[model samples]
Target chain A: MDRKELEAKIIELVAISYGKDEGEVTLETSFKNDLQGASVQMVALVSEIENELDAMIALQDASVCETVKDLVDAVEAEM
Target chain B: MNILDELFAKAKEDPQKVAFPEATNEKMMQAAYETGRDGYIVPVLVGDGPALKALAEERGYDPAVFTIVDVADEQYRDEVIAKYVALPDTRLKEKALARRMQDPLYYAMVMQKVGEADVTFAGIDNTTGDVLLAGQMIIGLKPGISTISSIGLCDIPGWNGSEGTLLAVGDSAVCTNPNAEQLASIAISACDTVHELLGWEPRCAMVCYSTLGSGAGELIDKVTEALKIANELRPDLAIDGEFQLDAAIVPAVAAKKVKRESKVAGRANVVIWPDLNVGNVAVKLIQQFGHADAYGPMLQGFNSIVCDCSRGAPVSEIKGNVVISAVRAAGQKK
Candidate 1:
């Protein structure tokens, strides 16, 4: 998938996982500050992204992700 | 004897001295009284002897029946504290042990740690956190247990899979989100718990939203990895999955969904949820909708039997939990 598609899928997954609006999720949206992505939500977001992207994103790599863009960047790096 | 009838019988057969530190509370007092009166346990109330006895009288319970361990007795207190501090693997020093012993909960646990009491039961007047903290600092965890978790017995009315209406589910009351290794430890602990407490040779299933290789995710990976780790750590156990609820318990569903020859899939007597979200919710659904009688959220992985009953639990529930604890402690004797 392209960069834009990857970002959109991640945004959708985050929105679904956190029960936020799709519009609320953005590239700049902070996972720790805004999303409060604790272990449960983080695992879920990474899991959904892995399913959508058809790629493996190690939780160790995903743990450092600060925002949606960071997650996308990690997935792209994996690809 | 599967639905705690066996434990109740075992407890009566070899009744243990169980300490109730929060005995001043009527529910705790009543549970202690009833469990003792019924011969499930010899309930020891740890607090001011006079106050407990007076409260027992006020509640129309016979005060003399309970062995009230007076924490204020400096002579007795010092002797017990010294013994506790001197035991192998004791975390606390003499001064710290003595100071913490002033608290009734600590006093009761110390009594157990030193072999005076078989089990320490509380949490009606205390929080789960309180009981757990005291248990960790005072009683300590079992040797192989890396994380402390809980196991509960669910006696579903109509669901008779392996153990005839009784199923064990765990980590619901503790561990918010356990990883693969912690999940493995929880599974192993659950196996030991059911075997020790209920006398069931446990068949454990690491539960998830998937069944075997049917789905994929980090969540599914966690459960599968947990089974791998558990198997590696203790090959004697029958732990399997990444099974969905039905595949874990229902034989027909297991035959359909899981093509592999899984020892645990079709007949899982114990179900270990991936995390607290699943464990906590599944248990409520089982109790409320399935109309199952859920016995515990009882803290396991302790060196001895240390129970933390929900504060909102009724007298009958408290009595049952105490008996469960007593029975578990009895298993330790063997």
Candidate 2:
């Protein structure tokens, strides 16, 4: 998928991970600022992305990803 | 001194308040009562205060010595819940936190989180999942901990290894199938656990079927990666591996098989399994055939000490774990 499509899918997964609405998540949503960088949510988000999108995102790579766009970038690179 | 005696002495040196949420279970209540009576910890039993006291009296325990409280007690419940919610870094959101606080397990967890209690001990009547979930939501994870895992001790009957008949194994009862990062976290946590509980400078070896790149597979790859990550994350720690069990602990095997200047190859006191499958089986083998006494499967990587006793465990075993956890809590206190 392209960048826009990948980002949209990641937003949905992030929303589910943080227990928020789909519209509430955005590309600029910072993990540290907004989500407190919870490792549990990061795990849920990565596993969901891998299962639903067939993209294997290593936690080490995703761990440094500060924003929704950063995570999307990591996933897309793997794809 | 033996490990148990040492732990008991250390625990009594500075007893922490351990909250038992399963107060209604006779085994749990009796164990808590006896533990408190012996002064290894200050026991806080959570449930209906009157019913807990009555049950303790019926069971021939001194109810006055134990502090019993109820999550449904509006004044105390509101106090702990409000304190926990006001903490700087809470894991759960507001609505979910409120809903979970209704359970005694979560309430006790919040008690520990807010510093009202030192350790939260349960899981006699609750599932391990329930206990872990409550811990994650209330107590939160230690900084840099990717996931919650467990560590245990095996006191083998008639043998002496580098650590003198005792070996620490981890993640046997939790984290079913861990990725490389999760595996590394388990090793790091186990290192900290053995250090705190047994006061040993941990020589943690990540044990798998492969010995220093001798084998190749996804499983072996995971262990090798975990070793690298663990070393990277905590370079000060003695974490090494991609060794077979024999190579990890046995000097002779390690000398022949491992061809590197590895710190944790032969004289390793702690062994971290790749996943729960290997960990669970390894513990059973040690217990049944090796005739070793297993001390834990004690949960680690949380901000505070947490444990989930086997539902089938007898009161004696539970009391031992309580002492063990209390000692760890005491040592881990910063």
Candidate 3:
């Protein structure tokens, strides 16, 4: 996936994880500091992303994500 | 100590702290009465208070010890009805508002919702869907859970001639067929549950028909994809798969036969089956032929405290499931 698509997926994932309305998330948003994703939610989101992209992304990797950009970049690197 | 033994000992030591004889069923009442008499948890019976009292008296038991919530013949129905109607989104309120329903399970859910009890166990005669629907409407899912699935605890004596072995199998009663993502999610949930329930750090095996990269098909693809996703989602979690059952759990068998050098080989306590058909049938075979003691199809991922009990569940199973639900709810409490 391209950067834009990856970023969009990250936003959609973050929104879904926190049960917030879509489009509320931005590329600059922090998953832990701003989005408040719990351990289970983080696990679920990574599961969704990996399925959508046909790749694996671990919970520990997702936990260190500070911004949507960082998440997109990390997922891109794995891809 | 074995978790089951510990639980039973706890049940024996402090009977008054637990709730029992939840409803007025003949068998449930009998078990609850006995459990209460043994000092497990306080027995709070829900139904017609006078009728319950009369029944207890007819059965030659003292009714004074059990607290009865008289909804049928008393104004407690309103109190019960109000509890369900207040649920964020449920038909129980509409049923009560229209005066078209009178069921104690809804009241039971409400009781659990309002903290009147620690847990509620039914399904003696109710279908799995019936119990699930009540829980979905009243207790709801825990925040962000997508679906609630069941797990079968399979134990095989001297597995491969060892002392004994335990396996947690899933989606036996809930999902019809799960996708790759669903499979991964179920495995993760099972891992969390096994860790908390059995005190076993989970080594998850995503099982397929073929071992390693030799298999090629949608089935194999699904398992591989699920394993990939599950691995990415919980990196610290000890999970690896796309292997046959032997490759997943038996290290000696895996090393000589399978190609991968997976850490999960032969030591996996959690087995994620391909689909519901495989999952359900495997668990049943293990329980029947393998003589494994199956504890639950305990529903997870829902908001409230709803659990599905087998149609042929004995009183002890009912009591055991109730304890499981109570512990689960207690963990979720704020």
Model 1, docking class: incorrect
Per-residue lDDT over B57-167 for candidate 2, one digit per residue giving the tens place of the 0 to 100 score: 888887667998776688777777678768886755444555566778987888888898889999988888678767776787888888999988989988678889899
Write candidate 3's Cα lDDT for B1-334 as tens digits.
Answer: 5556655555554342233323556777776676666555566776666878888888877676677776564366566566656766442344433232245665666666656776666777666766665565556655424556767676675565221466777867776777777777777777777665555677888888887776789989988888787788778888887778877777787886566566676777888888988987888788788887777887776654566666677878777776665555454452
TM, every model: 0.78, 0.82, 0.68
DockQ scores for all predicted structures? 0.02, 0.09, 0.02
- The best-first sequence of candidates by TM-score reads 2, 1, 3
Best by TM-score: 2
By DockQ, is 2 or 3 better? Answer: 2
lDDT of 3 by residue, A1-79 (tens): 6778777877887787678877778988877677765454565566556546655565567778888788888889888
lDDT per residue for candidate 2 within A2-62, as digits (tens), equals 8888888899989987888998789999888987644687756765675577765655678
Q: Which regions in candidate 1 have their CA more than 4 angstroms from the true location?
A: A1-79, B1-6
iRMSD, all candidates? 18.5, 8.9, 14.6
Better of 1 and 3 by TM-score: 1
